[model samples]
Target: MSANLESVTDTADLAQSLREVFGRAQRALREQSGRFGLTPSQAEALGYVLRDGPLTITALAKRQSVRSQSMGATVGVLLEQELVTVTPDPSDGRQKVVTVTEKARALVAKGRNARTDWFAKQLDTLSPGELRTLAEAQKLLGRIFP
Candidate 1:
């Protein structure tokens, strides 16, 4: 094969591998959140609020690529669970902002700790050299992502 074609093929394989690994990791973390009785959409919306501060249902819907009504239903579940609070936007009374509640923070922290504990156990099985290589690979991944 030509060198250029070979490089493209290798990149495509690597992209697929990364996607599969990320998907599996997401599933594993999702399982941890499931313990809190949260659906994937609810958990994802909560995560976005936690990470990005308060946002409107429209904003969240745009971020998630879902419809406003769909996001409203997801936020409704979060509100019902007391995981989020909705208040009128100070600057725009016509729109409401969704904010994560303290209860949601606690749940997120617990879920994070659970996932970290599980990951740490898996890391314990790796040799020191393997760990170092993994760390370097993580840095490369960061460059690709960031």
Candidate 2:
């Protein structure tokens, strides 16, 4: 409660800690996603679609920070796998929107469940204080992200 923001030193340690935590989370996701035979980017794109609903290729590209052409290719794979379908936009006939299919939803849900289960198992190893700290960290992360 007595902490001060002024006169702060270099934040290399804080930055490195964040990087390591993120790396571990990414690795965990990779293990779950690997079972589905998707590249990280593809998995990410599918998850994004799951969370955000249908989007056009250009919108997906912008969200994923990739080029439109690259996003188009990714969408092609999703389409070929029958994970998503492209339909004419009701408001704009010239544009097509990509939507997730039941199969894709199932895949995403399975990955999420697996990760949740794995993490839950790991959480059992932590003490009450550590669990409290982690709960606080989750809240802090939500604030930082949102």
The most accurate candidate by TM-score is 1
Q: Which predicted model would earn the best lDDT?
A: 1
lDDT of each: 0.90, 0.83
Name the runs in model 2 displaced over 4 angstroms: 1-7, 10-12, 65-67
* Candidate 2 C-alpha lDDT tens digits along 41-137: 7877887787899988778999999998898888888889999998888888876688999999898788779888888888999999999999999
Estimate the TM-score for candidate 1: 0.85
All candidates: TM-score: 0.85, 0.77
Model 2 Cα shift for residue 51 (angstroms)? 2.1
lDDT (Cα, 0-100) at 103 in candidate 2: 98
